[model samples]
Target: MSLKYAVLAALHEQPATGYDLTRNFRTRMANVWNASHQQIYRELAKMTEEGLLEVEEVPQESRPDRKLYRLSDAGTASLATWLAEPQGRPPTRDPLLVKLFGGDLVDPASLREEIERHRRNWQEELGRYQDIEAEYFSKPEQVPFRFRLQHLALRKGILAMEANLAWADEVAGVLKDELTSRP
Candidate 1:
């Protein structure tokens, strides 16, 4: 999906300044989509020009005025239409997987180290996901019905991290055995 749709969905939650949207992308929406602040600000401007977003300037006493963006009527309809359309899984394009496919050329030990690094990253992310689950979804049933889907999205991330960790461990084990058997 395009980043435009992600931006629309974020604004649909609530109006926000470009900075706030960037922060949300780094935190709340990190698992779903990744975009730089520049990309986000640029998209905001384009959407505003396209009549998909409405920008309201809020005055501030000390700092410069802030531009808050909200989804326009057209944006709402656009988002709804996109949501109703069926989605297919996008193809995965992970560099690590590609590297693993030709692991025989590289030193097995070095490849294992790279896999370990990825494993550590996945572990760290999994911990963060668990923290979010505990803080927001401790009592799932008590959560508002509207947010259940958000929780489900988090679940998807959690499961994905778990799967990656499992796969990495298995690959690392195979590489370790190969290294041990060599000498």
Candidate 2:
């Protein structure tokens, strides 16, 4: 998905300054999309020029003026149209998987170390997903629809991590057995 659509989606909830939007994106949309601060600022300017979003300047006493953005009618319509379209499958680009596929080219010790590292990474991700789920459950009434969507996404992520961890464990087991049985 384009960064414009993601920004529009975030603004759909409420108007927010660029900094606020960046922080929100990090928390709510981090799993699905990511944008650097510079990218977001640049997009905000471009989107404003395109008339897709409206910016309102909020004066501050001792700080720089904040330009809060809200979705214009055009932006809302654009987002709605995009949402109606079918989503394409995400392309896979996993370096670890590629390395694993080329296992025979690497030393056995290095290969095993990589697998162990992957297992640890997945375990950490699983923990983060579990924490997100718990936080969502704390205020169910505040985000009924969003909570459901988040839960579903978290479920898929957790399952994927679990599967990766399982595969890594199995590979590690085989490698250990082979090393021990070497004549």
Per-candidate alpha-carbon RMSD to the true structure = 1.2, 2.3
Give every collision pair in model 1. Answer: none
Report lDDT (CA) for all predictions.
0.92, 0.83
Runs of candidate 2 with Cα error greater than 4 angstroms are 139-142
Error of 2 at 144 (Å): 2.7
lDDT of 2 at 124: 84
lDDT string for model 2 (1-183, tens) is 889988988898789999998987676566656899888999999999999999899999999998999999999998899989999988999997788678777766787898888788889878876777677655555676956776676678778888988898889997788667767
TM-score per candidate: 0.95, 0.85
